[model samples]
Target: MRAHKITLAALVVAAGLSLTACQNDGDDTAATTDPSSVATTSPSAGGAGSDGSDAASPEASSGGKDTTAGAGTGEQSTSGKCRTDGLKITAIDNFIDGDPQGTVAVEMKNTSGRDCVIAGFAGVDLKTNEGTLSAERKGEPGDPYVLKNGKTIAFSVTYPLNETGGTGVRITNLVVTPPNETKSVTLPWPGKPSLPVTDGSGEPVRVGPIGSAGQGG
Candidate 1:
């Protein structure tokens, strides 16, 4: 009985020692593991921010520049072409002494307040008792003339004079059309009623291009 009691006490001490050794082995395994070695996810390049808003692009970051306004400052503004309503027309007798051709100077003054352009030949016609006779243009059309406010330009009409008082057309009025205009203005003939003869070209009247006031005839 005494021997059995001692053996039983020894068995209890060995079981307690084996349990302490197993607890120490578990503590060493937990201490050897590193926390930094755990896998984690990272944000992608140019991804959204933490607040869930998209990142700004290169164009949006820079302040937008205005490419339209005041871009045409280097260009000049040009005046419009002259119209008949803006002009005051008049006729003057421009015939010289002993000259075979009867010359009439038709003058136009720009009554409009703005500057205007007058280019090419003016259309001229002679109103007679028989009918309306249109004048033929002569020479090259010159450069455009700028007529300012209250400025004047003139053109001439030439025809063979009836010095012998032979059969001819009796003129009553002069009808004039400004350059680049479809409208017409009429003015009375400046002198006594006279007859005009047509030249070999069958052109009863000849009209010249627009020029300065005193350049006509």
Candidate 2:
């Protein structure tokens, strides 16, 4: 009877071991098949951030393009008359053979920072140290003369030549007024020369609609 009991106990122990092995295999299979047990990386990780950055880059580039398109890159228009304060005036003395009068060129340079226009003739007066000697305006009105900074335009002034018999009028000051302006600028007469004293019956001593430099006055 005792031998029979020992055999039965050994059989029970062997069955318990087999059952435990089956339960462990089932637990491993359940762990492998369960979705929560799986080790999975998030879908929106480093690669997803890179893709999002690339998409945003194109959007940023598109936004910059729109901004550029809204703003223009053309030169603004700066057309206007040259002011008297902005003009740098000079005189060029020249002579011609057989002419009864001496000719002088009045050069006007734009000293301002922008572009401007000067049209028609300039008003000129030949004055002495004592008082005004002769006043003339001989500029012919014409097209607008657009002048840029550092650009020059000139017109000619004719003055009666000094004669030996004391007929000449000595000029000390040259007062010049640009067109469309009431203000005037005074400059020294070329060489402080003299002009023939004449009555107001003859042609004007000043002649021009102002022209570009080196061109006909």
Candidate 3:
């Protein structure tokens, strides 16, 4: 009877061990097959969705196309207005026939090798031994002139003839300043040494607005 009881106890212990092993195997299988666990281990987990919605988005690709569309046109990046340093200026005496008395044309040529703009009136001053005489501006300014490479623009200066034969101001040089520029260029007077004018007169010499090369006079 004692042997039989011992054998029965051993059988009960084996049965309990077998049941625990089965339960542990079932738990491991459930963990490996779970949907959440499979998704976290996938290679494309955070990338574009399974339908590729994020990869095909318009906002993602539009920026690259916009940046390269109009890069090489060059017209949008044109050089700005002309400056005195880029011009070749010359004074022409009596350039126009039948022009009003004592009129001289000053021409400014664009030597900048690029297109630029010139407008309004140029500042003109006659340099004499006594002092500098500023020219009075006449007429309203016209449209702005676009000076192409190697092209020219001009303006006219009208001075009193001093027909009275009295002693006149002797002009040694002409100081010319382009419109909107602070610098100036000095050139020798084109014609006579003396610019005859009535003394103590208010703004005897007059300057006109800029125009086409020969049209100013």
Q: Choose the strongest candidate by lDDT.
A: 3
Shift in Å, residue 166, candidate 2: 1.7
lDDT of 1 by residue, 1-217 (tens): 9999999999999999999999999987776644423322234423543433465555644533443333553322356789899998898998888876778888888888888888788888888887888888887788777778788888888876766566566888988989888899988977436665555544357888887325422
Which pairs of residues collide in candidate 1? none
Report residue 96 deviation for candidate 2 (angstroms): 2.9
Q: What is the Cα-based lDDT of residue 144 in candidate 3?
A: 66
Which is better, 2 or 3, measured by TM-score?
Answer: 3
Whole-model lDDT values for every prediction: 0.75, 0.72, 0.77
Off by over 4 Å in 3: 1-77, 95-100, 197-199, 212-217
For each predicted model, how many residue pairs clash, with residues at least 3 apart or on different chains?
A: 0, 0, 0
Ranking by lDDT: 3, 1, 2
lDDT of 2 by residue, 36-140 (tens): 534344444546546756545565666675577666633223467889999888887777677777788888888898888888777787777447754465545
Model 2 residue 77 lDDT score: 32
**Local error of candidate 3 at residue 150 (angstroms):** 0.5
Off by over 4 Å in 1: 1-77, 196-203, 212-217
